[model samples]
Target: MAGVYDPSVQQLRSLLTLAEELHFGRAAARLYLTQPALSLQISTLERRLGVRLFTRTSRRVEVTPVGRALLPLVRNIVGATDELRDAALSSLAEGGGLRLRVGLTDCATALGATRRVIAGLTTRHPALEIDFRVVDLVEQVTGLATGRIDAAFVYLPVAEDFHIQPLTTEARVACLSSTDPLSQRASVCLADLADRPMVSLTPQVPRAVRDFWSVDPRPDGVPVRYTAHEVSRVESLLSAVSFDGARAFLPAVAAELYPRPDVRYLPVTDLPPCTFAIAWPEADGDAPHLALLADVCRALRDEGLPTDPPAPSPRTDPDASVASLAERQ
Candidate 1:
């Protein structure tokens, strides 16, 4: 008995290309092979299969009935082979070690929890390398979309195309100058700030986000007045409030992270809390390690170990679960 012969992927690839082009020269050019080489591959494939695959005339080339029948099968094989190759390459990359590029906004990095999250992630995946980039609020979205960063820790109300995993939600506070009378109050409301000059962020920040931070309209339906200063960085915004007698709203964590003798953070009693989340491209949401990172964040939050000193209980804690906060609102 004779042994069976298996066709090589290179031969099948040649056959597939030839079937699509139906021109020996064109197929050869596409495959980066000489016409004779392509012809030899087709001939070899036909000989092994014991079937004729093409009918060649001086004018044109046509696939024989057998060739037509095998065309779809060959295409499927090639597609599957390519998928296998890609999977193998991915596995190799993971085995050798993988790097995740993460973006962080100024406020996000200011969180003590952010550092702990990164530390936990590294401990969990010893083979993983992290590349952290600092991006501003508006640039975080663009960075994820452009593949400049794989993931980011950012505030909520971003583009709908991103997949957001909420990490923490904290109460918002008003940043005011120590000289301001409002600074004496334990807490303040949007109505109290209705006539005050609020520091406006640059136009690059989304209008909705800016509106929310500016506390756009007083609870009584009056528009919050804007100061002449338009700033971009957190330091600049704080400086404007500290020296210019302007006011701005920030996440409560900002109060803890950036304490200044000249600035006071009074809780905005009636306003909703600011939600911080991990955002990634919706397309790559399920890619390996992202879920693990989210899990680590959740664990850290649950343990109350996210802050510098770590809160003792959820009741006394300033941080709350993203899901629970959303549910309440």
Candidate 2:
């Protein structure tokens, strides 16, 4: 077999550095370039490679197998290049450069541990530059797919083929008005909401929403008059719910994020918990950025609040699964 050298050595160098640093902003700083410039360089490398090297979610980053395999080779090449730099530095007595860029969802409060991970990258790689982009879930996915984004913190229900890195776990809680008669109770059970109207963040499944509110083995199918996607729209949602005397199912963490004077949060006892994972494309290649994001996500996970929301009742069947709810729907 013949040895092949990439003509895009500078591009390759940047990619390898990104893989090592596992973050864009830090890598960019090291390169002495703006974050966008650094991102363009990595994007260019991916374009030439003809294969995707990374996967990202709003919460974290990941490297494909291709990225992993390429990392060591990249390190070796960069090291060799560093030796060349050392020779030049010895002669001229000059410094070098480093940088990195990071992408994330605008919802910073929701990202928990991922924030610390970025800080670590900057501290450990002082020479590196860090750049961050606030993006949405879909945009984050597209970024990883097309190489525009190195890594991100994203929600679940992503492509299965991608390598998923779990950052933390969060269970759902029902957000209700404090003024509601039910809110007077310390906690509320799923069955308690049987006939009550509700608000929801467009459910992954209509059945899932129905199941959450159903007390009977079969759902009575109460109407969800309000649906929303934006977290900021909770005020409007709350207004809608209040008008209808409805309650909404939300992640416990999310519930606390918006503390309405008129509303309170209660866990849906005996419900299955939702786990948020940071996913990346699965392939063998060197991807430094993705790995870096994953580390950050894990750190965020460490700071995560308890996944266990207060149970509706100890006597309630813990065995009750979402599948059971799915069955009725």
Candidate 3:
């Protein structure tokens, strides 16, 4: 009440990004601003607050005591601003358009199925704007629960509270080292993988989901062997399979989608097929739009339509332009 403090929303966002990244270049890249511009924003904000927020050195950036104390408050302000903007946009409908946030789980190999549904929705509702995010195993349902994503194409074993419809099921394949003896065979069973320990998934993943992916407590009732280290992403899992004498279960499509010279995907003969499902919050079960989305998903799969290709991967260059990314995707 004693101080006059007003900082632009972009400045506050820059503060949050810099705090999270702790590096000028990366934070600037994320903000789509030059380093000097970001530094100016931070400095101006600090001037108004009458406190230094960060201690900067050539090699590193450290948050000051005040910065740490202010982070939660800054987060709240930013979150509220975002919520208000979203509400206003919803009311306006941006030219009578509907914006949906769709999530693609890292474990969703049936991406083709999800895309077909998107296409169907687009054909029917030309004004629908689809904003989809690719989330990892850790953030699978977190995105949905937090409202970051309106719906999700996720692997099975999602919480029972959500309305889920199985879209497509594909046989699981064992991702193993190309040099492993079992890789020589056309296919292998769970028993054949006894010596090959499973890669432990991230601790944050739900127990039931992990069990579903790992096929825990083998069909023969044998204890499944898992590696001591845990992996949270596909790249890490691929590295583990390549060098750590570990194996992971992925949908058979991985053989083509993720091709690595040192890794081989052998069909797992004994394990049951893994399924992908389209899930949404239970509250939306009666919503006409969501019902239509689910129907499109089911029809695409049941009708055996040609699979939809995934958007191409964008360039890794930090300076890549938005137009370039759009073209690639």
Candidate 4:
């Protein structure tokens, strides 16, 4: 490249750091280069850029007015360049058609948006291959932490260690078999079904869900009684083949995931709405696919679904509902 505006990133960084530190020795220490080496690099940069970037004396080192003006621009440029390099590395990891593995714990309220994010990422960044996995909340957390998965569809509140981005809120509902008498009602309340045999998430319910159910307080401080989790359980415990009168609390997404002829989903008028987020390891920090997926998720959340989701019933008490009741078990 001919010299009109040709700039070496290394030289620009050295200049920027020297300006920032205002001390040759300190700047060299920060850059892990010797002071003389840094000085030489800075001199070379000034020569190449055809400008005096700094004025130096034994007493002090100072950026010139031109250098000061250029400092902010240089910082932004260098920072952006670093980000670009990281992103390029990330793309290379994704480019070989490796699966951009995506995982979901219990379904969240924003399934529609989640689907759109996947579609958009795949279409916009065709080099990435995406595979979606459905596991429980604990497994999702462990997978992200261990780098076994790139991103997880998580319902808040996730454990503190993982980074999360909110997607959407969903109303909590009670799912039942169409054959059940409660299915005849347009809506159901927790108090109304208090005595009914509930298909409780047998495993420890995720903290967020427990809070939604108000596990600490009951009308009579009565311990909530429900059926335990059973393997091979459909989203709703009730199915044509497994048609047991078990009612489970779920978000709109879960209901949609396992739509069944024999089962009916009814709004729970007594619970608050649940929120969901996309989660990945804090360790993954800013993995590009994760970052891009988060961006795509945000876009999908803002623009909304390509097709309208079912009308959310007004009977639900959004304040108390949880998003992924499947995690409750």
Candidate 5:
């Protein structure tokens, strides 16, 4: 327990928001508070909890191990609080108090298209209460299929049952510790990481999902090693790569969305690219709001897909399915 020091719901939301933004200024803006105020809240939160929730420096901020493990629970609390707050509101102009809940598989990713589409939706229907719920990968699929979620952005290799829209298929990049020898190179091939142990996902993950992420069936026929550490959260996995002697293969989008001083993302020359898509069930195909979302997606994607690494690739981006984390662990 936190003793007699109790934090308000808004304070907790501030913690969640800051963890998502990973920047004091941006997180403050989102909460409509000044930078100093946000700093105070975070400091107080850390002091009260007796744990350092985030690591910060002049260049970047990152969630600490404790913070990553606590996120799923924190998110659940925040959602319940928001739902209660909304129920107390008597009226809305357009949405009439109806909540459009969209499930996100990622907790912290700055995706461009996701931002624009959400922005467009807000501009067009300000009255609609959009609850962007961060959940696990299985939940992302199950939630949509069962109507627990209005829609979701999921990575490729998913079941064919859902109506899907191809978003991005970017090259897979190698994630390594900044201090590792390979980090000195600008680019790397899969062979370079043959000896490094990789962070493992939860055991329940399907074999296909595991194989794709682990780069199983290597071109060189080299087997991979697994670290003792297993993570379901992206932050935790990144932490492993940074502090532990581990390596991973992730979508190229990570180079930007998750810039870290202790980690280096090098494009892998030999691995195949992974795809991400926005999906919904056939049952919701005719929903009015979903129709608007579909139209917005088409227009925005046609303009161009997200090109990651600040380098020109055919199509890429944290921009496409920033939801790639969908906790696809």
Candidate 6:
């Protein structure tokens, strides 16, 4: 490779860190370098690569399309290098067992799929040690990209760099305050909530993912009204609905996992169902451990023991009531 084309591992590491943080100062702090030093490194890398990695303004920083495209490749390179180093050290240690860290969103945990998956993995790989980390929905993609977690059970429509295996598909449901008039309905249509203020995820969540969850632009093409308060966790989101009178749309599994007297989950008759899947770095798809886990998931699905609960049936009339959406579905 030419001299200019040969960027050091540290340079690549800095680029990956900056891409994750999207803030020069914070990325500098994480890398233990001054902001100026980090900027110089990024600029040098871009000059050598002949591509602008990021677009920076006074208030915000955004990665360009090229930067997004390169991010996973850089991450895989760094991850493989680190794994090689770890492997060398593990070889010198006694009775070193392989460990895989799996990430889960709240919905995954609530549905008991993570537990079943872990159990199956343990049975298949007796010596493997599995660790489960609860990650917020918005950060699951970032977690996978940066190798913070080996694989994650997350909602669909992830970036192109991920390999997603469909797990379970469930109906979409709305979370509204019990006192809200819509809550009285057996099932609500997207148009019914058109005028109500909905709770939305923070901007950290990708636009497409957020829009999908928010059920934006009711089938009629007008955007659903959303409150200013953006939540990052399911607990906070439900609390907002219970007390703040804000509505939210989530998977039917959420209704099963979290049953609150103050909130009602009503099926959306028109919106498409949400699909949750196992997402991992596409570069690492062929690794034995990841492959085994994926196999376990597929086996469970084939056996008809999905991690998610069954989707509840929609109510035919507002006056025809049921105990809860979970029971109906």
Which ten-residue region of model 5 has the weakest summed lDDT? 320-329
Q: List the candidates' TM-scores in order.
A: 0.60, 0.48, 0.60, 0.56, 0.57, 0.64
The regions of model 5 sitting more than 4 angstroms off are 1-98, 124-127, 301-329
Candidate 6's residue-wise lDDT over 112-196, tens digit each? 5556667877765566678888899767888888988989988777888888776556677888888898887778778888877
lDDT of each: 0.73, 0.53, 0.71, 0.64, 0.68, 0.75
Please, what are the lDDT tens digits per residue for candidate 5 over residues 206-322? 557767898886788988788887576677888999999699887766666677778877766667777666777777776765665665564444344442323323323222322
Ranking by lDDT: 6, 1, 3, 5, 4, 2
Q: How accurate is candidate 1 locally (lDDT)?
A: 0.73
lDDT of 3 by residue, 237-321 (tens): 8889889879898776665566777887765667777666778889876554465565455435334443222222322322221
The best candidate in terms of TM-score: 6
Model 2: per-residue Cα lDDT over 27-107, one tens digit each: 665554577897787777787777667665566556789988888887687567756643543333223342334456543
Ranking by TM-score: 6, 3, 1, 5, 4, 2
Between candidates 1 and 5, name the one with more favorable TM-score. 1
Clashing pairs in 1: none
How far residue 1's Cα lies from its native spot in candidate 4, in Å, is: 35
**Which 10 residues in a row give candidate 4 its minimum summed lDDT?**
320-329
What does the lDDT come to for candidate 2? 0.53
Q: How well does candidate 3 match the true structure in TM-score terms? A: 0.60
